[model samples]
Target chain A: MKITIQVMVPPYSYEDLDTAIKIAEAALDKGHEVTIFLFSDSVLAVNKLVKPVKADRNIPEKLSQLIKEKGLRVEICGICMDYRGVNTDMIIEGSNPSGLPELAELIYTSDRFINLMA
Target chain B: MEKKVLFVAYQSPVGSVWPNEVFRTAFGMYGEDIEPAVLFLDEACVTVSKNTKPELLGLFPLTTCHRLIKRYGTPVYVVKEDLERYNVKEMEEIFNPQILSRVELSDFLHQFDLVIFM
Candidate 1:
């Protein structure tokens, strides 16, 4: 199954991001294709400049690593990023800019769509 | 074949963005291969009351959503358990929303190809 998740909250603000990652990892482990669509504050999770202490878990870095190692596809909302002043240079290297059309396409194509928000 | 896609709204619509965002996404799927619907479950049934006004909470009026739901023929649903909790047995008949029990809802959910919820 192809699973697409739409995340609307920022990382670390709540358990949404972490839980999304766990679900994606579990799905991937089961040989399912997973893609995450970051919108609203969730676009912040793709920022490469998110630095945390050596002891703390860096959520954005974890997402970036997943994109590299686990083939997790992350697409940040273009308008949401623009509104938040998030440029391509600031986001995870593998993440791409997308729009509502892409989100609709993701919804239409995916076997499962998970929306993580308040 | 039309793909059944459900957007589950679990928050009260007064000032929260989840219900608005969920409905907006479901409505945005105009002229698509997807059949998008919005379900008001959990605390979201607070917005299902006939007299509730989102504008009173400084949010946009839901009349616009009602208009879109009518025009696009999008399905809107509120949970029976939640309605009982809020003592709101009489909801606006704008779309004549389907009221399903928790168990019936679980069974109905299986009919969808995708279910989006936080």
Candidate 2:
């Protein structure tokens, strides 16, 4: 099945990012094609400046790597990123900036759509 | 064209006005053309509680989203795990809402053309 996920919660804390990552990994491991669209505060998940201060996981880096290795489509909401003052240079490598039009298109085309909000 | 839109509200309806605003927007935009299905999970389940009295908050005290949307023939389901976790089983006794499990929720995702999480 093709699964499209909209992550609308910011990954300010470890628990939040962990949950999002786990869900994405689980969906992929279950033999489903996955696309993650980051919106609202969730755009922070791909912010390059927000480093994992103490945790060993480094979720943003992990997400970036996963995007490259798994060929996962990672789209951050363009409007949301602008509202949050997130620069394109600050976005983690491999993730693309997108808007609601793409989000609507993904939802229309996917077999399943999941929203992980914080 | 008629489409299936699954709306997921994951926030509390009291402290924040987002739940109502988003729903109102969606209803206005797609109410006539789409079959809207709502799922209340996590803190969002409180919005459907029979005991909730939104009147005291001085806002438009519209607590029963199920009833409001159902009037328009939309189907609303509340997550059973969330209700159990919040000790809101009494809500079911009062409102008789459809109880949905995780698997059932996953299946519901497959049936929708679009899923919006607020």
Candidate 3:
């Protein structure tokens, strides 16, 4: 199945990002196609400036690696990123800024969609 | 192409207009071509509980969107973890919404064509 996941929850507190990563990885492991869109507070998950402290694995780093290794496509919400004062410089590698129109188009074209929220 | 769209509501359902706005936009955009399902997670689960009274808000109402979506036969799933945190697990006893677990959520992800988070 072709899966497109939207993440809209807080990046750190909840396991939404972890879940997205796991799902994406599992989907690929199972030979399924996957795509992810980060929106709302979840866009913060892709902020490269936010690094994990001692004893915590950096999610953004892990996601970026996964994107490269798996050839995953990620679209972060432009409006949410702007409202949150997140710039392209802070975005994790391989992720791009995107808008609602792109999101709408993604929703229209995908074969399967999942929203992983807080 | 006809696809299934999953709407993930991660924000509080009553305190803000985000959830309602998302629903309106998704409904307007997808129309009858896509099957839309609303899943409430974290604080967002409050929108579906029977005890929630948005009438006090006096603006758009709290459960108005929930009611509107249900009228279209949209299935709303509440994350069990969130419901437990809010001490609103009893909502299932009243409203009978599908309580989703991590595994169930992962399974649901596979069933949809697209998942949009709001």
Query: Against the true structure, whose DockQ is highest?
Result: 1
| CA lDDT scores, all candidates in order | 0.83, 0.71, 0.75
TM-score of chain A of each: 0.95, 0.88, 0.93
| Each prediction's DockQ against the real complex | 0.36, 0.16, 0.20
**Which 10-residue window of candidate 2 chain A scores lowest in summed lDDT?**
A12-21
Report, to 2 decimal places, the DockQ of model 1: 0.36
Better-scoring candidate (TM-score), 1 or 3: 1
What is the docking quality class of candidate 3?
incorrect
Against the true structure, what is model 3's DockQ? Answer: 0.20
TM-score of chain B of each: 0.91, 0.79, 0.78
Q: Write the per-residue lDDT of candidate 1 for residues B1-118, one digit (tens) a residue.
A: 7888888888878867777777777876765688888898888887667887888767778888788777887888888888888788668888678888888986888988878774
For model 2, the DockQ equals: 0.16
lDDT of 1 by residue, A4-68 (tens): 98788888777888989999988888989999999888899888898778888898888888889
By DockQ thresholds, what CAPRI class is model 1? acceptable
lDDT of 2 by residue, B1-118 (tens): 5668777777787776556644553454341445666777788787668776667878656545445565554556788889888777456333345888877877878897766777
Candidate achieving higher TM-score, 1 or 2: 1
